[model samples]
Target: MIDSCRSKADFAALRRGRRFDSELLWMSFAADAGLARPRVAFALSRHAGTAVVRNRVRRRLRALFREHADDLAPGRYLVGTRGAASAVTYRRARAELARLLETAGAFPRIKRTPT
Candidate 1:
């Protein structure tokens, strides 16, 4: 399961982390050897939209993160939503996030076996 980054230190550390950006969102990642799973935090500025819009986007992003939690590397991720993110469909958002994570090498390669 993915954990939420709740501590001030965790958020602070993201400032020093490697960053990746896309039209929908920008992300920062910092590897942590002590982590058993990926931890994430979200940021949405007022420019994103009204409170309702921001919450909707946050919920969508959270669901997408949960679906990919197992694939993610052990790290802390800070995800900031762009205005476009508040307007996209869930499928498009998912696609963008997948591409972003892939570009960041956040998802490790898994071997497959033929049955």
Candidate 2:
């Protein structure tokens, strides 16, 4: 199961980590050797929307993260929404987040055998 980043240190460590951005959101990832599972946190600015809208966006991101947890590296991730994210459809947001995660090397590279 996916875990939530709850420590202040974890959040602070993201400053030293790699980041990937998209029109809908930005993601930061910090590899932690001590972790067996990935931990994630979400940040939504007031400019993104009202509480209800922000919560909806947050929920969508969380669901996407959970759905792809097994494919992600063991690390701490901070996902923040952009203003555009407030109105994005779930499919569009998923596509954007998938691209960001791929860019950030969150998924392990698959080695191919010569056929």
Candidate 3:
């Protein structure tokens, strides 16, 4: 199993000065302090829906991310749902994420500083 580097600080540190829009959600790799592997922090705002709906959105995004973790290079990613994401299937989500990754300059080379 992929070690989950779940930590509140990890997510918090990522949001310090990062900026994003409807197009993508991303964060660089952050050390778990507790675990060596990088973790993910998804951002599904209340604007997305009610708690039940928000949880469902997160759940779906998590499952989709879990399914495609292998393709994503190591990073403490912050995922935000774009306008397209609201209506995408799992397959579409994966493809859209891949496209975003490419657009974000994440591929060809994933830049990393000392963590």
Candidate 4:
């Protein structure tokens, strides 16, 4: 199961971790020595939109993150949105998030055998 970063300390640590950005999102990641799966937190702010819009964007991102939790490396991750995120569609969010994960090199590498 995907873990949630529920403490301020954990969130602070993530803030100090490596950061990545895209047109739709901003993310931070750091290795979590104590976890076997990645933990994620959302930091959507009022700047993103009204309460309804922010929650919608947050939920979409969380869903995308959960779908790939197993594929992600064990770490503490935080995803936040800018003013533009609320304007994005689910498909765009999913595709952009996937690209962000790839840029972070967070997915495990697969070994191939010569055939």
User: Could you give candidate 4's per-residue lDDT for residues 16-78 as a string of tens digits?
Assistant: 789989888888987766777788898888777888998889889889988887778888888
| Tens-digit per-residue lDDT, 32-99, candidate 1 | 76888889999888888888888898899999999998788888998887775567679988988898
Top lDDT model = 2
What ranges in model 3 sit over 4 Å off? 1-5, 16-36, 82-88, 105-115
lDDT on C-alpha atoms for all candidate structures: 0.85, 0.87, 0.56, 0.83
Error of 2 at 112 (Å): 5.9
Scored by TM-score, the top model is 2
lDDT, model 1:
0.85
TM-score of each predicted structure versus truth: 0.89, 0.90, 0.58, 0.87
- Winner on TM-score between 2 and 4 is 2
**Residue-level error in angstroms, candidate 2, position 68:** 0.3
Model 4 poorest ten-residue lDDT run: 104-113
Model 1 weakest 10-residue run by lDDT: 80-89
The number of clashing residue pairs in each candidate reads 0, 0, 0, 0
